[model samples]
Target chain A: DQQVKQNSPSLSVQEGRISILNCDYTNSMFDYFLWYKKYPAEGPTFLISISSIKDKNEDGRFTVFLNKSAKHLSLHIVPSQPGDSAVYFCAASAQGTGNQFYFGTGTSLTVIP
Target chain B: EPEVTQTPSHQVTQMGQEVILRCVPISNHLYFYWYRQILGQKVEFLVSFYNNEISEKSEIFDDQFSVERPDGSNFTLKIRSTKLEDSAMYFCASSEKGGRYEKLFFGSGTQLSVL
Candidate 1:
């Protein structure tokens, strides 16, 4: 059983447009969520994270929204640049536990110029 | 700008042989973890360690697998007997604390191939 799930395998968006990626989880115990981006042959780089205490957190052009009531979260990138194209993974973990992160299968994003 | 580092970007070992994948986590981080992804599969957690002992491990981490923090900076994952199914990209990560919300920094990963 996959506790964290990303139903989409890929997504495409035109440059300068808003790109939205969604994720879902079955475990209500998860109190925090994170998004990581990865390119070919490199490790995943931390993008943004949101704690359950707040529904949203923003860092520059990236924003993460969490809906605990729905057991879901989403990452939004505005004015999506070409450099933002990569595999985005959604991860979550139980509250107050060790830093054990459960990652989604990843969604491949393509930014078209 | 601390980052996790792994040795031997790639490794190949014969079946039944013992193989150890090494990692040097961020200089000051205290929590370490090991994860792997088979081609076209989700990244799965193998084990997590803190204070030189394992905090949690998954069902996939069987008796054949073991983790050790041999020194102040080095963390290792050893497969006692290699199997072809073990071929995958192994990533090592570290965090400043064991808090559930802590963001982890990962290494480039070592591609392990057991023939």
Candidate 2:
């Protein structure tokens, strides 16, 4: 049962450009969302997260936007760099669900130098 | 910054053999979890541990799977009888607090290969 889904398997963008990755979750119970970036052989590293009460959260070069009504969320990387190339996964967890998180399949983002 | 640590970066064993994957989560974290990802598949949750007990587990965690915090600082996952399909990268994660709002820190992962 895939509660969270990343429709796009891969995305590519030129350096110094914007790269957007989208994710959708079917479970309305999910109130917390997070994004993780993973390299080829490394474990996923936490990038950013947003609570259901907020629509957007921004970190250094990454920003996550959540649309509660649409059950969708997106990650935008501004001025993408080659180091930003990695597989990005979106994860969600519903309140009172203990510590279990549902993760999307992940979208591989390639930033061309 | 502290991080989760998984041992035996790679493990190879015969089918039906028992295997134990070890992990040491950050000292202050209260919640620990096991997740695995088969090549070309999404990361799958196996179990979550809190208060020295299993708080939740996924359907994929069957009778053959078990988790333990046998000591003060170590959390472990054991597969009684491994199968070819059990080959995957197993990740150990931890969070400072228990709840949906807290983010998890994941280990590099232990690659298990059942021949």
Best prediction by lDDT? 2
> Which residue runs of candidate 2 sit more than 4 Å off their true CA positions?
none
Q: Which runs in model 1 stand beyond 4 Å of their true positions?
A: none
Candidate 1: Cα lDDT at B63: 99
Interface RMSD of each: 1.1, 1.0
Least well predicted 10-residue stretch by lDDT in candidate 1 chain B: B96-105
lDDT of 2 by residue, A1-113 (tens): 88999999999999999999999999999999999999986789889999999999999889999999999999999989999999999999887777788899999999999
Clashing pairs in 2: none
Q: What are the lDDT scores of the predictions, listed in order?
A: 0.92, 0.94
Tell me the tens digit of each residue's lDDT in model 1 across A1-113: 78999999999999999999999999999888899999988899899999889999999999999999999999999989999999999999886556668889999999999
When summed lDDT is taken over every stretch of 10 residues in candidate 2 chain B, the lowest stretch is B97-106
